[model samples]
Target: MNATPLVLAVLHPRVALFELGIAAELFGLARPELGVPWYRFETLVAGEAAAQAVGSLRLTSDGDMDAIDRADLIVIPGWSTDAAPPPAELCDALQRADARGARFMSICSGAFLLGHAGLLNGRRATTHWRHCERFAALFPQVRLDPDVLYVDEGRILTAAGSAAGIDAGLHLIAQDYGSAIANRVAQRMLVTPHRDGGQRQFIPAAYPQRRSQRFDAVLAWAEAHIAEPLSVATLARRATMSERSFLRRFQDATGLTPMSWLSQLRIGRARAMLESGDAQLEAIATACGYGSPESLRAAFRREVGLSPAAYRQRFRMRNAPGAAAITPP
Candidate 1:
């Protein structure tokens, strides 16, 4: 990687402003307090010098297709799914970028542009849930995972929808820097720091958060006591309901069962610990209620698609104490 990577955001016609905003907020804005080399970001339009955007807004692009040759990472914000195919020139530039090993990322409908470039032929990718059917039909060879917030196939990354762009952008930040830096960026943005990419985009919440006070309290209590061995009976007692009733209500409030929710919470905590500290696997496992390092490794791999050790190695803070002495599991 370059000392200061250049991130070029491609702004095609009728680009969704929110997705583009996500790219700019994440990579374009300067962060002086981060004390690290930040990305050099530019917005490029395919054709004209000025473009019309949603909400009757006009934007003068910073660069053109020629900028792609100098970019280390390229971002395609939401594209027009119904509009004509991207210009042949734009597609050719993307193909060249791919051949030279530049990373590509798409937000929501932007995956359509990638598909038009023939970049997602056999790779795993995703888009907004609303467009999954059409995207799958349009490109049957692409392994479409509609459930995930984002899919990171290494070189090509795709986000689900509007807000999911934030998650994917932070993920890229985590990749370029580390999870600690990503979490700091997310804190500045007032958003949750590290939502795993494999987490489901849609949760079947029969009662929306505004209407689920009792549900919220239960969730808070469970999270506060995440290190304890929790079960249906214990949670049922806390909620003052029968086990079956609590289970049904919990399933309705969250799309996951009691145990599944607890497991995800434990894994999330374990991930935070690994990213911010230099604790050993055995200690991290015990603190996260996994009982042993082997158990933690098994659950971490099953849920996160990477072992705890690997995740720590990939995302651990660089300046942490004892970081140099810790060996991989």
Candidate 2:
């Protein structure tokens, strides 16, 4: 990879605004504060510089499909999930780029184009969960893991859905500049520093949207007292429900059990603490509601695929202004 990789976002007709915006935000925007060589970004379109997009929006590209020849990283913001083949010129450009070992990433339905170009053959990939069945049927050669937020198969990457694109982009940043820079970028964007790619994508809500709001106070309370011992009984009492009823309702609302939700919440808090500070393992373990440093290590490794110490060392933001310190409750 070059010190300054050229990132080309390939836009198609009826492209998704959110995914395209994510690409521009992650790569196109300048960040002098990072004090490192950043990506050189450009938009690529086939034929005319202007193309139609979702919401009747018109997008103009900085270059034509030929720009693929120069891009180190090519981003397919999105494509329609239908059987209609992409432009022959676009596929040819992508195939040529792939033959030369240029990296490729697809967001949401954009995997369809990569599959059409024979880029994902015999490689593990993912698309939006809703389109998994269709994607599988369309490209039987590609090994589809529909549950992950994103799949980073070295050169070819695919994000599960709309928001998963953010995770995928941050993963790329981490790969290029280390976790500290990636976490800082995420902080500037006001998003979580990291969500493991192995995390599940399908989180079903069994209750009406309004009813799920009942747990808002409980969630806030739990986050506020994350270092304290918390139990289903105590949570149920706070919500004024029986233990069994609370268990069922919580699962219905959150797609996770009360303890599971709390565990993840604690892990998120721990990750923030690890990224922003140089606190000792014992101190962090205590603040994150762990019984011991060993327990913290076990859980962090299980959830984040890194030990707390390793995570801290890799992601601790140094000398970045506006990086807030996370206070443990």
Candidate 3:
């Protein structure tokens, strides 16, 4: 995107103030304090109209919704596109823009707009949990996973709820800037750098840190020997502690039990192998100690919220710092 990335946030008569507010806080606001270049924000409304939100709060938007066709990032912050269908023209414009290659994101019910535009078809997506049943029923073709805070399907993304909007926003920032910058923004907002018990290792985060020297050393060793057997009992022995004591200490330090932490490390290794090379699934699974491709796929789906294949397609080679994807224009 030119010098400064253009983030176009969509507003409508039914937009949610909280969702829009978070988007503004993340990308719309100026942050010379960040000491780095940031997004140039804009807003678009269908037909260049102004209307009251929920029929009370007034919102004035400049320019036609078709302007999304030019935005580097298009955000449908929140809209009731399911109950009241978005205009045919607006939906068509979004589809055309997506085809021409722009990243799109939604928060809460805003996913309904992307679903309506057919951008969610065959794509993993989510909305607020309360609306999960309805969203799935309405968009049967969309692969709806109701549990994750957000689903980043390459250029098309969806978040679960109002507060998850903050998670998604911070995630986007981490994807664009580095985790250090993202953490600084989260500090300014007075929230955890990675929320909800932290995300996957493959998911961009503040990077791994050690809480204890001994435990960190054991962990470092285990990561290197991940291809071998790593039973919790074995790890406990390596840490020179009883299984019970080691379990408690490991969880306290990493927010995951010994076994769980090992699983995460294995999954992270598998992801790296998937991204950096063309190793066969069986080879990757065995090298990561998953035993088989099926086992790897199941764990990958549960932890990362997508099959290993899908994750590779979205992230392989394209995931450098500050850029998540590059769809052809």
Candidate 4:
């Protein structure tokens, strides 16, 4: 029998409980029937033997720094943003494990610990947006990307904040097991299977719709007439404003240019059509205003990084409830 992979979660002082919980939920669960070998998870606490979480919740670990050397994957949960540097022993252990090919990952502010250990130098990483500035200032060599939810640079990974940790963990599972198994795990956890890591962290919860009532009306009209060759001039004429003024206001309200927003909408529609498996590529392209199948392919490849046929193959729900036309890639 093959040995199960041992995932060691190294807990730092004042670790965020929620980040630790996510690791435990994903790695600690035993699902042998899923056709994947079991994973052995051990929580290792550093410094003072025991640690207290946010609400004075004390956690005692059965393992210590030694576990890092034997781990197949090392997970650093969130650490205190205000705390001093990590100890030399922890840093050395991490460096040794990394040298020996053990994967290292961080969730939220735990990225600071990895940064301090010199593991993130010259790598693209992210933390909670609130701490991104400080993280960059502290580790100038590391390329800090604050806008995205997470970043995966093969062996090293970093996530943004609370819920983003879940996305990062699910991505790791997807890399270890195929998408189908990852989707099954996500279903069991009641979470979205895949959220592109590059998606914006916060999309402005309240978009102040009342302030842009006229713009909203114009947007609705544009959506209704996607097939029509609508231009900025046409939209400005409909709103009874100069083209320049309309362009500026549209960007300020939507954070995207009119053509860019239209392309996104068209691609969204194209994706739905591909998943439905009923519409031909050329028909879907015309319906979504791409004018031709070649245009749709170009737009889909640019936006989604995959052709429409590939996207359908990866995401279409096979054995969908309703009996729809099933087109094989």
Q: Which one is best on lDDT?
A: 2
Clashing pairs in 4: none
- CA lDDT scores, all candidates in order: 0.83, 0.84, 0.80, 0.81
Superposition TM-score, candidate 1 onto the true structure = 0.61
Checking candidate 1 for backbone clashes, the offending pairs are none
- Candidates in descending lDDT order: 2, 1, 4, 3
- Tell me the lDDT of model 2 at 283: 89
Pairs of residues at least 3 apart in sequence or in different chains that clash in candidate 2: none
Question: Which 10 consecutive residues of model 1 have the lowest summed lDDT?
Answer: 201-210
| lDDT per residue as tens, model 4, 195-237 | 6424231421122232467687887888799877889899999
TM-score computed on alpha carbons, candidate 3: 0.59
The clash number for model 2 is 0
- Badly placed stretches (over 4 Å) of model 2 are 196-201, 205-329
What CA RMSD would you report for each candidate? Answer: 11.7, 9.5, 15.7, 8.3
Give one clash count per candidate, in the order shown. 0, 0, 0, 0
lDDT of 2 by residue, 1-329 (tens): 89899999888766688899999999999999999999999987655668787567798766976789999999998887888788888899999999999999899998999999999999999998779999999999999987788999999889988888999999989999999999999999999977643433133211222247889998888878889889999999999999999999999998889988888877877877777777888888899799998999988787666677767776666765888654433
TM per candidate: 0.61, 0.62, 0.59, 0.62
